[model samples]
Target chain A: MAQPIISFNNVSKRYPGGREALSNINFTVEAGEFVLLTGHSGAGKSTLLKLIPAIERASSGTILVNGQSISTLSGRGIPYLRRNLGLVFQDQKLLFDRSVFDNVILPMLVTGQSHAESTRRVRAALDKVGLLDRERANPVALSGGEQQRLCIARAIVNRPTILIADEPTASLDDEYADAIMEMFRSFNQVGVTVLIATHDRDLIAHSSPRVVHLQRGRVLDKATA
Target chain B: MNALIRHHLHSLRQSGVRFASAPFAALANMVVIGVVLALPLGMYLLVSNVQSLASSIPTEPQISVFLTPGAAKTDVAALENRLRAVEHVRSVRFVSREAALASLKRSPGMADVISTLRENPLPDAYVVTLGEGSAAAAERLESELKGVPGIAHVQVDSAWVRRIDALLSLGRSAVILLSALLSLALVAVTFNTIRLQILTQREEIEVSKLIGATDAYVRRPFFYWGGLLGASGGLCALLLVFLAQVLLNRNLSEFGNLYGVELRLQFLPVADAALFLAFAALLGWVGTYLSVSRHLSKIQPR
Candidate 1:
C-alpha cells in the first residue's frame, strides 16, 4: 500500500487565551481516502484542517504530508506546499470584486499556468461546477449554493492532489448540500483525497463515510464505514 | 522564468486596471505629487537661470589706474604699456584728462555742471581689464598695479560682481534645501497612498495568501501601482514647469526689452527631466516596498 497522503502523530494546538484547540491528535489519511471530521464548535476541527496547509502549526508533534515533515517548511516553502492542496472554507471566501471566471483562474495564475492553458482549464473547472454560463458574472451576484460551487471550482482549478474543506455545506439547503456532497464524491472517485470537517450528523448518517469525531480538544471516536 | 515574466506583466496590467477604475482619485493623487515636485524643481531652475544671467553681464570688472598729478602724456603712455604687460592685465585703455572731461560734458545732466568748473580737474587714467580669475586674483593685480611709479590710486571694480556671485551661491544652497524637503514630502505621499491601497485590498490580499500566493505575488501589483502613480506625477510636474516657463518667459522678455537686455529663461534639461522621473519612480517603489513588506506580514490566512 502507498504511504498515507497525510499523517499527524501526537499533534497538539494551543491558541491564544490559553485554550487548547487540539490535544494529542493522531490520524493518518491515505491517498484517495475520503474522511469526515465531525465536532461541535471549538472542537479543533478547523484547527486540524488549518494545520495541513501550515496556516496553523501544531504546538507539539509531527505532521507528514506525502512523506515530507511540514515542521521543516519555511516561509518560502509554504506556498509550494499549499499549491498542492485544494482548500475550501465554509464562508465561501470568493473575491466578489472579480468575475466568477477570474476567481476560478486565480489559483492557476498563482501557479503560473500559460494563458491559453489557464483559459481552457478555467472553463473546464467552471463547467464542472455548473457555472460555465455565469463565468462573467461577479461572485456577489451568485446565489449561496452557486457561490459555494464557485469556491469549489476555484479550489480544484489547480488540480491539487489533496482537497480539504471546512464545513463546506453548513448553510446550504438540503438539496444544495446533497449536490455539493455528490460533487465531492465525483472528485474522490477520480482519486483526489478529500477531508471535510463538519458538525452535520445527518450528513454522517446519510453518506456513511469514515467518521472522526472530536470533543473539546481530543478525539472521542473514530468509526470506519 | 516565463512565469515570472507573466507575473510582472500581470502586475502591470493590474496597475492599469486599478488606474482606470477611478481615474479622478488617481489624478488627484498624481496632481498633489506633481505640485509638490514642481515647487522645488521650479525654484532650482529659477536660481540656475539667475546665476547664468548674472554671469552673462559683459562688464569686464576692471582696475582703474589713476595717474599721479602732473604726470606727462609720455609718462601715462609708458605706464599704460607697462600695465598691459602685467600677467593679469588683459588690456589697458588710456583715458586722458581731456577725453574724460569731454565725456562728462556729454552726460545728460553733467554738461552744465562740468562747464561751470574753471579748468579740467580729472587726471589721466588707464582702465585695466583683468583676465578671467577670482576676486583674490583681482586683488593681486590691484596690488601689482599700485606698485607702478606713475600710478596714484589703484581701484578694483569687481565689488558689484562679487555681490552677485555671493547671492547666486546662496540661492543655490536654498534651492538644494528646498529640494530635499520636497523629496521627503513626495516619499511620504507615496507611502500613504500605498498604505491605503493595502487597507482597501486587505480582503483580496488575504484570499490570495490563502490560495498559495507568495509574498512577492501579493506585492507585485501594488508596487507597480505606486511606481505608475509616481512616474505619471513626475510627467505632470514637467508639464507644469514648462507651462510656467512659457508664461514667465513671455513677461520676462517684455521686461528684457525694456531693460535693453535679452533675457533667456531655461527649463530643466532633458537629462534632468529624465532623472526626475526615474527618481520619482524610485521613491514610489521604495515607499511601496516599505508599506508592503511591513503590512503584508501581518495579514495571514487563519
Candidate 2:
C-alpha cells in the first residue's frame, strides 16, 4: 500500500574504462521488506547496493530512495540522505585507532547527536551486537567475527530506516555467518528494511526469503523461468 | 546548541590526544618552526634597536666657528657675542687654541698624539648651539655664523650622524625582507606537516565519510591540531628569541663598553609577540584548510 522504500527504474552503471557493471535494472522494494541480492563476483550486487547510498552513481535511468529522486542530490545533500541509511562492509571498516565505543558512536557524532544521548545509544547498539563488554577495547584486537559484528553495531547505531550490507559474511565461518544472519533477521523483524548482497548459496538456501538473482549484469526473469 | 558544543569539545580533546601521542615528533616539528621564525625575529630586534639608536642620536646641531690661525683674542671674544645674537642660536662658547690643546691632552689616548705636535695647531673656534636641530635650521645657522667678522670657516658637525642614519634605513629594509621570507617558509613547513598528517589518517577519513560524516565533521579535529601545533611553535619562537637576547646582551654590553658605546638590547615586545602567535596560528589554519580541501574531496565513500 505504501510507496516503495527504494525504486530502481532501468538503472545502469558503467565504469570509466567502459566496463558495464549494471545494465538497465528494474526493481522496487517496499518498506520493511527483507531482500537478498545474490550474484557472482562482478555481477553488480555491490554496485546495486552502492547506488542506494549514492556511493556510485548510475550511468543512466533513476533511483528513488524514500520516495525522493536521488539522482540530482548535491554533495551537501549526500550526508543527509545517508543519515537514514546504514551501510556495512565485508572488510569490517572499523577505526582501529579508536575504541569500540568511539567507532560505534561515530555516526551520532557526525549528525551532532547530544553526548548524553549518544552515550546511551552507543551502549544500546554495542549491547545489541554483544560487544558492550568490549566497549573500551581497541578495534584492532577484535576477532574477525567480532569485528564484523562491530561494523553492524556501527551501521545500526544511528537507527537508520534502511540497512544495507555488502557481502557482510564473506570470510566468516558457517556459525558466525548464521549468527550474523540471525542478527539481520532480528533487525528486519523490527520493521527495518534490510538488503544484503552476498554470493553464498547455502545462506540463501536455508533462509527461503525473497532472492533477487543477477547473472553478469542482468537480473533473471524469475516469473518467466 | 548542546551537540555543537559537544562536538567542539570532542575535537579539542582529540587534538590534544593526537598531539601527545607522538610527543617527540610534534616537538621536532615545533622546533623546526621555531628556528625558522626566530632568525627573522632576532633580525627584527636588531634592526629596531639600530633604528632607535640612529634616531636618538644626541648630537645637537652645533656650528663650529673656526677663525683664521693668526686671529686676535679680542676678535674671538667679539665673534662669540655676535654668534649669540643670531635668532636661532641657543648658546655660544669660545674655545681658545690653548684650551683646545689642553682638553685634547686630558683625553685617555689622545695625549701622545697631541704631544708630538710642536705647537697647538688648532684654530680658536666658537661653538654655536642652535635652538632647533633640523638640517635646514643648522644650515641657516652655519650661514649666519659665516657672515660674522673674523670667521674663516663654519662646519655643521652632524656629517657622521647623517651617514649612520642612511645605513640604519637600509638595515630596516633588509630586516623586513628577511621576515617576509621566513614567514613564507613557516607557512610551507606547516603545509607539509599537515599534508603528512592527512596521508596517515587517510583510512580514518574514508571510513568516517562512509559512515555519513560531513566535511566539517571530519575536518574539525585536523583544524584544531594544526592550530595547536602552530601556537606551540609560536611560543617556542618567543622563548628562543628571549634566550638569544639574554645570552647576547651580556657580551654585547661588554663589547660596547670596549668601544665606548652603550648597547641596550630589548626583547620582543608584547604586541609583537601576540601578532606573531596570531600569524603562526593563521598560517596553521590556512595550511590545514588547504591540505584538507585538496585531499578530502578525493576521498569519498567509494
Candidate 3:
C-alpha cells in the first residue's frame, strides 16, 4: 500500500579499476520491516549498505530512499538524505578523542539539535544501549562490545526512520551479539525500518526476519520468514 | 536562527579550546605573523612621523623677484604692485637693499662677511607668496615675474620642500609594496597551519561527514581558528610597533636635546590599530577558506 522505505531497482556498483561490488542488485524493504543482508567477505554486503546512505553511488539503475531518488541527488542534498538514516559501520568508527557521551551525541550535533534536547536524547540513547554509566569515559577505554554498542547509540540518537548497520555484531562474543540483536529487535518493534548486513549464517538461521542473500555482487535469493 | 547562532558559538569555543591545547605551537605561528606584519607597520609609522616633522618646518613655497642694480625705488614699487596682481599670487613684500643688508648682518656669523663686502652688492627684492604651494605653480609664477622689465632674476625658493615631498612619496610606495608581500606571507602561514590541523583531524572530519555533517558545519571551527590566529597576530604586531616607538623615542629625546628640538616617534592611532586587526582577521579567514575547501573535498569517507 504505502511506498517502500527503500527500493533498489537493478542497482549496480563498480569500484575503480574494474571490481564490481554490486551487480544488478534489486530489493525493497517496506516501512517497519526488519531485513537481513547476509554474505561472505567481499560479497558486496558493505557496498550494498553504503549505497542506501548515498556513500557509494549506483553505477546503473536507481535507488529510492523514503520516496527520493538517491541516484540524482545533489551533493548538498546528501546530508539531508543521511539525516533520515541511522548508519552503524562495521569498524565501529567511534571517535576516540571524545567521551562516550560526546561520541553518541554527534548525530544530534550535526543535525543542529538544541543543546538541552540533544542532551536528553543522548542520555536516553546511551541508556537504551546500556552505556549510560560509562558516558563520561573515553571511547578508547571501551571494550569491543561496548564500543560496538556505542556506535549503535550514536546511530539511533537522531531517531532516524531507517536504521542500517553493517556487520554490527562481527567482532563480538555470542552473548554480546545476541544482546545487540535484541537491541535492534526492540528498535524495530517501535516502527523503525531496520536493515542489517552480516555474514553470521547461524545468527540469520535462528532469526525469524526476511533475508536477502548476496553472492559475487548479485542477489542470490530473497527468502521471506 | 537560534540554532545557527548556537552552532557558531559552539564552533568558536572548539577553536579556542584547540588553540589552548597547543599554546606553544600556536604562539610560534602567531609570532611569525606578528614579525612579518610589524615590518611594514613599523615602516609606515616611521614614514608618517617623518612626514609630520617635515611639514612642521616652514615650507611655504615663495618666489623671489630681484631687481637690477640700476633700478629706481619707483620701479621696485611698481613691480611689487604688478606681482600682487598676478593670478594665484596671494601677497608680495618689498625688501629694500639696505634692509636686506641689515637683516643679513643680523645673523650670528654674517656681519663679518657683510663688512668685508663693497657698498651693498645686494639688490632690492619682492618676496611673492602664492596661494598654491606646488613646485610647478611656483615655477610658473617665477617665469611670469622674470618677464617684468625691472626684474633681473626670479628664483622659486622651495627646492628643499619639494625634495622632502618626493622622498615621502617614495617611502609610502615602499611601505605599500612591503605590506602586500608580508600580507601574502601571513596568509601562507595561516594556510599551512590550517592545513596541518585538517590533516591531523582527518578521521574526525570523515566521521563527521558520514554522520550528516554539512561542509559548512565541518568548516566552521577551522574558520574560527584562523580568524583567532590572525587577530592575535595583529595584536602582537601592534604591540611590537608600540614597543619600537617607545625604544626609538627614548633615544630620540637624547638626540633631540643636541639639536634643541623635541623629536618623538608616535605610535599607531587607535583607529588604525583596529583596522589592522580587522585586516589580519580577514586574511586569516581567507587562508582558512582556501585550506579547507582544497583539503575537505579529498577526505570523503571510504
Best by DockQ: 1
Clashing pairs in 1: none
RMSD, each candidate, Å?
3.6, 3.7, 3.4
Fnat for each model: 0.61, 0.61, 0.65
Which ranges of candidate 2 are over 4 A from the true structure? A222-225, B58-63, B69-154, B256-262
lDDT of 3 by residue, B174-253 (tens): 99999999989988999999999999999999999898998999999999999999999999999999998999999999
Model 2, span B49-167: residue lDDT tens:
77777677755677788899887769777776667777777778888889988998886678878878887888888887776556678887777766566788999887677667778
lDDT of each prediction vs. the true structure? Answer: 0.87, 0.85, 0.89
What ranges in model 1 sit over 4 Å off?
A222-225, B54-61, B66-71, B74-124, B129-134, B140-154
DockQ (Cα-based) per candidate? 0.66, 0.59, 0.65
Better model by TM-score, 1 or 2? 1
What is the C-alpha lDDT profile of model 1 across B62-148, one tens digit per residue? 888788888776877777677778766677788888998999888666887887899999988888787766556677878876667
Q: What lDDT, from 0 to 1, does candidate 3 have?
A: 0.89
